[model samples]
Target chain A: MKGMTIIVKTISSWVKVLIFLFGIYIVLFGHLTPGGGFAGGVILASSYVLLMLAYGREFAEENLSLPVASKLDSVGALLFAAVALCGLCCGAAGFFFNFIQQRWFAGQDRAFDLVSAGTIPLSNIAIGLKVGASLFLIILVLSMFRPDTSTNEKE
Target chain B: MSVPLPVFVAVPLVTAFLLPIFGKKGKSAATFLANIATIALLVLAIASIGQSNVYKIGKWPIPLGINLVYDGLSSLMLLVISVVSAAAMFFSIRYMEQYTAKAKYLSLFLLMVAGMNGVVLSGDIFNLFVFLEIASLSSYALVGFGCQHEELEASFKYMVLGSIASVFILFGVALVYGNTGSLNMAYISQAIQKSGLNAGLGFALGLFITGFGLKAALVPFHAWLPDAHPSAPAPISAMLSGVLIKALGVYTLARVLFNVFGVTIPIGWILVVLGILSMVAGAFLAIGQWDFKRLLAYSSISQLGYITLGIGLGALIIARAGKDITAEQLAWASLAILGGLFHLANHAVYKSLLFLTSGSVEMATGTRQLKHLGGLAEKMPVTRATCTVASASIAGIPPFSGFWSKLILVIAAIQAGFYWVAAIIVFVSLCTLIMYLKVQRYVFLGELPENLQQTKENKGSMLVAMVFLACLCVLMGLLLVPGLRETILTPAVNVLTGGYSYSADVIKAAGGM
Candidate 1:
């Protein structure tokens, strides 16, 4: 399909950056707030989806290629798993996902702080990355089915 | 020392994530790492046998935090899963090379393994459901990996039924949590014991049976298995047929029914009927199939019937008599459970081997149609030998693993004074024999199709994987010997026969009961 009208494209270009930033904020502060990885990740993915809607498929592909998105998805997941493994022997009882501040941060009493909620924030970041990449990839791939886009262009 | 429960799941999850990074170019490295991860899991499973532990995740208390529990049943399931998965992974090292995106296949395979491990080891009901979804979703994608028309069709069919089952299960879990105010299995059991089966709980139980029975592919709920199993890559077919159904469907059914809901006579009898119907229907249907993998898929339903029947019989007697049963009845129940558990392990090995051999045939000949393929015995001796061993084991020939499990099932049924059940079991055995004989005749003994004259045996990792399972089929009878039985089957039987103790054990492991 043709790109959106110039006015729509121009507005989306400015608004999309705000959406991406808001998603990052939510993921970073997930442990202390209502919004978490999944919520934030979808917000992030929507920015890209918005880009595709306004700028057309080719523009979106130019910005974030399929292979790069796929790689980022895997990297996000691996990062999550790695974070879990790092704390495998650190839980108070030595189980997985034990990100107690005292265990790694050494007896610091930093409650209600950004980095004080143990491994949760790190995990949230990893999940946010994964979910965002996955959603973006899904939307991009699905968008390839349009009448205006040939299958070869998807590759 | 006991291994931590989370590692059972974590290792594979980590491996799954890592493999995809290797991508299109580093396929060999990806396969090598995947193989190592599976072998490591097998070693871990074997090492952790007879050991039990509850790992409190994030260091929180049981009711507050999710925990992973590994006990007799968990260990048994872990053993079966890792064994079949290791073999399948090994086989796929070579078998999957022909398919593009081998890295993604290996990654998905490991994801499925991780999901299965989580399902088996999970102490919380909702955790089980999450893991179940993870495994089911991966298997669906893997089934349609090649993106062929038939593969996509089969995958879609399997996905629709599977999703329906998952929805039913999630609904049941919701009902359970709403009723008991808890999602932990042990707490749910305790609450149920205190309150008894109210209307909501009863509804949940029905939902559980429908959901799990669908996953197990019991007759009337088994429309997807024949199509889905044959469409996947060979090793995946082996994994799906071998342990996925048992771990996801039958194991969960047995666990929830006995340990959580407290097995009742009615539920027990229903399981028996379901088992019998699946057995009879699967056998009759399998006999008429010309597609080699389709026949194996039907036979999976038939063999799963034996496992279900054995468990159901034991459940019937135990549920009827409770803990105060007579010694003879208890003996019969334990024997029945033993037979069921043993057959479960035996089936995981032989059925996977059977599927892998079919895979070898397909890889060599490019088709699974029985009529169009024959005289592979001369060209593919290792595959033929492994296939014969597997067929013999499944057909319940003398001294094979299948014979011993069947013998135990018959003896248990007779001792329980269910003579008709024994007769039906024998009749099913005969039908199984006939079906395999047909497989042998058309697939091995008949004239070779001209198009397949240049077929050669699949070598390397495929051969090794097949031989490993084939040898296991021959040696599995040792599990029935008194000393080995004490080490293996008895522990698993104790887990089931002592169902009332499950909550107590979990509570004790978690802390003061």
Candidate 2:
């Protein structure tokens, strides 16, 4: 996939990949550090924003549509609700109760480890998905209506 | 009994940060996740009710570190926030289609909810200010979600006033800290009790009243509300009008006045005056509105007045314990408060339903002007039915939620020998009825507009949202039934009547000094 991309007129293609990877890193480490779903999501969307700025709107549009983004938003919210509902199913009293605390899963040691803190890790991932998709989709929708600078200059 | 109150704030705080990662590809996943967070919050809120708990943040004890307090009042507010946000989130599934940035909107919405939940649960005064700002700032941005000329203008106005209110609250907090040497509300209350209200405390109280009054959109400070509330999208309008003002403005004012500073006669009278003024002025202003949502906004001010009056009257009755007034009068005062809270919840549900229905109308017919909209009932049966239920409830028609609450308020007023206040309550109810009737006649009962001849009902999640709130409005009266009343209203009322005992209760519950 990296070898196939030869269309960027400015900046190395590796830079874009690096930026995307950094965004993913932020999202994954959200719970452990300052950057979580919202920050990480915005970071992820910026990669696409960079792609649009570098590769143009056509490339972005071919990859994602407005309706598809809306659907992602619905699904993300539903997933968040479902995670909370798990607590209720276990008779733990409320949504998002830390029911997993009693169950011992592999790799669930350490205080700040992803899966160690019960529902926090799962909730964080759900939020990251919602925020990332929402940001990117909004950017796409905005970009679709962006004025053509080339045409404006010609006119 | 030993639950940490901070979890309410911490969960959403964490989730809000985490939601953005899925980016464009995971928008559906994001929405699902946000819903789950709120549902979890809802369960937490319900489970926490009737149980008084305090969690000191960072394991630091109160007076040194911030604490979150959950009592009847906080639990009640939490329940209202959860129910309304859940409905709003469900509605947003389809309603947010016309707008872009669905994820950003949801994140902000959850943030606002988290802020309100925090405000209600926070035992620290300064922390309340922080949460209040979080909620207010998000709301201001949300109001202008459309970025249209009107929405932008309204958002700016709301931001300006809201910022000013925040400043006032912060100033009040600073004064309280300086005067009492404490940021914890219970500690401040204890300090005030030790050394009664000094001039600085007095000034703080005045500032608090003005700040929260502006937030509540009381009569004098309500200019921005009409424009701001109508400008937002439907579910947003619902959330803002339904619970935002009550949670941030009214509930905070009641908590600070009753719990922190301690209520006095002069302060009590001031609240009563503000309440009555808001009621009369809000209803009168609402009667003249041609826009459907704007009318509801004005009515919100009026309804809030009832809550303020109920609480203020309770304070006055307690403060004026003399040879003339007896314990029965005190009980009557409590009854009045119970009525006010009941009305507050009822208004939140029905008002939000009304706004959602208006959104549906606007979505279908492309306009919200009462003059332009006509006979939508024929086309949009679901909206029409829901609107009818909400309108009847708001109008205080028999068997609907509003009527029972209003009745209780009036009866309490009369029993407490506040006959004039009772008359005023009835007068306001009549005006409310007239305004809603005008809405019904112009928007639903009149001849269908030629342009809107092909209007159809809003289907899917929107219909479900409206139906849910409408059903709640009708069934809410059942809350007055003996068994249910003991569970919900009595617990909430006990929290308020408990007054200064709140501190002791919290300390005892936490096994502290």
Candidate 3:
């Protein structure tokens, strides 16, 4: 029974990883397509939920503690804010104001590079990170209150 | 002048994320950091006033790249948002101790603030929707933070309604984009002005009114408010009633309707009708509530109605131009709007203070049902004192912030030839007074309950927070004085008065690049 449970948990974990990767793909392509940070992050968080459901609370907690996830969430928000702050400090007009007019990389003009989109790509990535972490943290914390069924059933 | 507009959103957004890291152990530290962030924002807001600047999100020029626009209106909103959030954050430092996930609560609170700030500053309609969702979603989760049956029920109800509102807004944005081929508000306004009023623009306007109205909890769409406001924790309640609704709903509505759509007569009348309905209905419903917070919540809807009426009336007068209305009439209408905006700011302070007082009372005696609460004045002096000031303000007693705004609104109504509306304002003021007196009589004036004999005042940060806001309630009336009025109120009014010129100003500030 223990071996079978371990195998099942591993398979579930792999599946979650796959789902998370797919969600990242969606988030990355969000600006150009339909899916953005919010939808993609939710998808990513749902993968964690699936793992928790398949393996149990303890399994999920061990891999993704609430504190750790929350910290990541904060960092993501900070990264996003920091990008905007850079715009502010650079005299770029205001927050989230992308001021980079052109790009010169490796002695070549890369004005149209994906990274050259200024605050758009940066904000998108930041939003993706913050949304994913926030959803994960919220889900994890809320799940901690799941009632003990055996005691209630016996009572 | 040099402040980046997006920092207003980014700072809180970053801090909100960083806040949860403190966990249970570093909750106090997190709280302090959050307070500092809000204070920083308050300074920035104050500094940014009277200045108009635009930041292109990715170094790209208008019509292609997203932007954050900062001007008189956005700065005013930023100031209100920061002030309310700071006070609420300060209150939560002590109030949230009873709850287990203190850090998580702070995180969510900051996220909501970040979202509101973004909504106010966003230059792009699609970006506004994104921020609106962020704020709405965070508030939904915070409302359900307690996870009790009532909290969850309210949260679920709020979430359903709120999500629907967001979808409406998103659909509106998509429609506008399809019609104008631009998402930038300035570009859209320019397009609308160039194209004239088309079916698509009119439909978009209707969708915006519905979406923002629901978000604002205007009379027709106010069902979720009474249930949702009183369900959250006291600080969250304060934020929601005090700043969240104004920032996410009223401010956005006014920005879009006035600056973006250029405020036609029909739209203005629609706003006035909505305002009158909310004012009369909300006040009447509030008078019957026994739940202390619920009464306050209902009152919020009513007060917001007055603000809408003032702005809408102003827009109507301006649209009519010269036939029956002069520029003075327009000014008078703005005076009404100024009153509404003033009331909005004042209400934020006093209402949050009231909620904090309610939280203190509930914390001490363990009940919020008015019948179960009585004569704790001697027991909880700080709370009783603050509650009295806040209640007096809400009741529109002379010398309080609420009175000045209500008086301005009434005066403006009468001057604008809307004598009945003026009379209604006075009548509603009386109704508000009666309801608050009932609160005072039931909760503070009567004999102390036997079960609450040992109830004591909340100390530390909670008392500090209550005192801070109470002091403001007494002093806020000074905002009408010449220097202060010129500095604060006039700038805000100018933004609205600038009308369609707003798009021109924004484009100009971008150096017409």
Best candidate according to TM-score: 1
Candidates' DockQ values?
0.64, 0.06, 0.51
C-alpha-based local distance difference test score of model 2: 0.83
- Please report, as a residue range, the 10-residue window in candidate 1 chain B with the lowest summed lDDT: B55-64
* lDDT (10s digit) by residue, model 3, range B1-513: 667666787778778777766667787798789889888988888887777778877566786878788876787788888888888888888888899888778878988998999998888899999999999999999999998999999999999999888988998998898999989999898988898778988898899999999999999999999999999999999999998889888998999998888878898799899999999999999999999999999999998888898888787777777345566776786797788788878888998899989999988888999999899888988899999999999889999899998899888888878899999989998999999999999998898888988988889889988999999999999989999988778777888877788889888877664
The number of clashing residue pairs in model 2 is 44
| lDDT by residue (tens digit), candidate 1, B1-513 | 778788989999989989878778998999999999999999999988888878787667887778788888888899999999999999998898789889999999999999999999999999999999999999999999989999999999999999999999999999999999999898999999898999999999999999999999999899999999999998999999999999999999999998999888999899899999989999999999999999999999999999999999999999888768998888899999999999999999999999999999999988899989888889889999999999999999988899999999999999888999999999999999999988888888888888878888888999999999999999999988889888778988888888868988888989935
**Which regions of candidate 2 are displaced past 4 Å?**
A1-155, B1-3, B322-326
lDDT of 1 by residue, A60-138 (tens): 8899999888989999898888777777765335555556676667767787788877778888999999999999999
- What candidate 3 gets wrong by more than 4 Å, as runs, is A1-67, A83-106, A109-155, B322-325
What ordering of candidates by lDDT runs from best to worst?
Answer: 1, 3, 2
So what's the TM-score on candidate 3? 0.89
Q: Runs in model 1 with CA error above 4 Å?
A: A91-93, A104-109, A146-155
Give the better candidate number (1 or 2) by TM-score.
1
Alpha carbon deviation, residue B278, candidate 2 (Å): 0.9
**Reference interface contacts recovered per candidate:** 0.76, 0.00, 0.76
Q: Give the distance in Å from residue B447's predicted Cα in candidate 2 to where it truly belongs.
A: 0.7
Q: Given candidate 3, what's the lDDT at residue B388?
A: 96
lDDT of each: 0.92, 0.83, 0.85
